[model samples]
Target: MNPDIISVVIDKLRKLSPEKASDLTVKNAQFITLQSLDLDSLDTLQLAMDIEDALGMNIEIVNFPATLTIGQLSEHLAEMRAELREPA
Candidate 1:
């Protein structure tokens, strides 16, 4: 993903969940860890909503298991945005 997009995502997520700000960072597509953050269930849900609204893209969490790390989440979001720009 682009650094600009990554930076924006991190900024928005950090603003919404400052406690998790320390956990925000980019990693290889499959290696971003989310376990370091103390986010509870509700926080996770709200984070998802905030990310979707910030990026103007719908994130599909149903298919992804609940154990995603911040890196994985970031990668997934970047992929979604890229997919949005591509033609069907």
Candidate 2:
């Protein structure tokens, strides 16, 4: 998992769920699962949208379900990064 993506996830998640703000650190965000964040459905949806906006990719919730660890989510987004890369 890319540290960059993990940082974005932590930053966005912290802003969305301020109660857990302190806990959502970039270093550990990858180890935690989204389900463990205890966010309501709305927060989760907004987090997805925030991540999409930050990454400039269409992130489907199905592809990045709450069951996935944050590291796994980063892996998914990193795959998107590779897919979107232009030929050089």
Candidate 3:
């Protein structure tokens, strides 16, 4: 389940990458080092949107933790995805 969500987030990030921003679009095999992609702050917000769209979760930046890393983002999204799956 976590893997699925992670893949979705990664795919969304890839799609958001500028077509000319090859530097920002790492090969799928290198998603783990996404921070190395050199995405700007705006791109990060775009990433959040992608995550929300993919997970169908409401992700407010103010509610987001300060932890800023690809692995951490994946974990956070996985947690959100799990919560979304729960009966509410």
Q: How many clashes show up per model? A: 5, 0, 0
lDDT at residue 5 of model 3 (Cα atoms):
63
Instruction: Summing lDDT over every window of 10 consecutive residues in candidate 2, give the lowest-scoring window.
Output: 22-31
Worst 10 residues of 1 by lDDT: 27-36
Which 10 consecutive positions of candidate 3 have the poorest summed lDDT? 23-32
**Winner of 1 and 3 under lDDT:** 1
TM-score of each: 0.65, 0.83, 0.61
Clashing pairs in 1: 32-71, 33-69, 33-70, 34-69, 34-70
lDDT of 1 by residue, 1-88 (tens): 5676566656665775687566566653245444445556665677667667877877655523457755556667677788889999
Q: Model 1 Cα displacement at 22 (Å)?
A: 4.7
RMSD per candidate (Å) reads: 3.3, 2.0, 4.1
- Candidates, ranked, TM-score: 2, 1, 3
On lDDT, the stronger of 2 and 3 is: 2
- Stretches of candidate 1 off by over 4 Å are 16-32, 63-66
Give all candidates' CA lDDT scores: 0.62, 0.81, 0.61
Model 3 C-alpha lDDT per residue in residues 1-88, reported as the tens digit of each score: 3567657756775676555345332243234444566566677677778778777788876433434445556677777667888999
What TM-score would candidate 1 get against the native?
0.65
Question: Which has the better lDDT: candidate 1, or candidate 2?
Answer: 2
Native-to-model Cα distance after best TM-score fit, residue 41 in candidate 2, in Å: 2.2
